[model samples]
Target: MKKLFFLPILFLLFACNGNAQKKSSDKAEEKFEVTKTEQEWKEELTEAEFQVLRKAATERPYSSELNDITEAGVFVCAACGNELYRSEHKFDSGTGWPSFDRAIEGGVAYGSDSKLGYQRNEVHCARCGGHLGHVFDDGPRETTGKRHCINGVAMDFIPDDTK
Candidate 1:
């Protein structure tokens, strides 16, 4: 019985090791290098962007203009103007923050967040280490089971030309 248990535990350890190695490999492939200085970012972004992106400050709940915005456009990073979310994925989560069901491909990156003694999926700009938001697994089934909880100050909405 001890031998049997040992074998299963060894197999589980190997599986976990394999998964960890794969993730490190994946991060190495996807990791982006920041190429801008603080002054450059400050010149490019407004005071709000500096606070939310660089300082990792959270905006007040229910204080984002994008929460009620129902326009057809792309939301770009306020710091670097990297296209982050599209209008199609925007949704009302009633969470008092700008919520999105999806993200623009290659626009955002995910990492483990351990702040406040809780682990979460921390979403940041792919081009910059600017904090965009946190992602949750509970979302509408019609969409991906992902809810990107973002701050309004982190994004700049660009209305579609039709508007």
Candidate 2:
């Protein structure tokens, strides 16, 4: 009957609503040291930077200028200048993005990212909560064995001994 059809639709709607509420609460629990309005972020970042950092959009593979960087430095968050990773931890993951074996202490935070259907670890700046990239397990076993695959556009490198 019509009642049976409505029951399944109602259940589906209720389940989806519950999931959305949980996700929103999960985000609320994460408090960043730096907060800004959407306009503020847009004004400060370039178009590509805004798209990746604020909107969590991934840049095209191999499109980042920082992918080939080999200098000694620290990578800072493009939005708030928070030091997120050290040059020593960076490696070539061959995924066309800058890959780091580990993040600097207290610089980045890891969260569950279910955007791609299955859950993955998402790396973001702890200061401003700007999207940096995701982490995966297929990294060099000699080190942490965790690959912190990051967006080059989301970072600004400040070399050691900048003098």
Per lDDT, the best of the predicted structures is 2
Against the reference, the lDDT scores of all candidates come to: 0.82, 0.88
The sequence of per-residue lDDT tens digits that candidate 2 reaches over residues 27-135 is: 4478888998999989989999999998889999999988988999999999999999999899999999999999999999877767766777888898898889999
Local accuracy of candidate 1 as per-residue lDDT tens digits, 1-163: 8999899889988888653344321233454566567788788777877888876778999998889889899999887778999988989898999999999999998876555556678788898668888899887788798899999999989999844
* Error of model 1, residue 14, in angstroms: 24
Candidate 2 clashing pairs? none
In candidate 1, how many Å is residue 154 off? Answer: 0.5
Which regions of candidate 1 are displaced past 4 Å? 1-34
Tell me how far the alpha carbon of residue 69 in candidate 2 is from the true structure, in angstroms, after superposition.
1.1
The prediction achieving the highest TM-score against the true structure is 2
Each prediction's TM-score versus the true structure: 0.76, 0.87
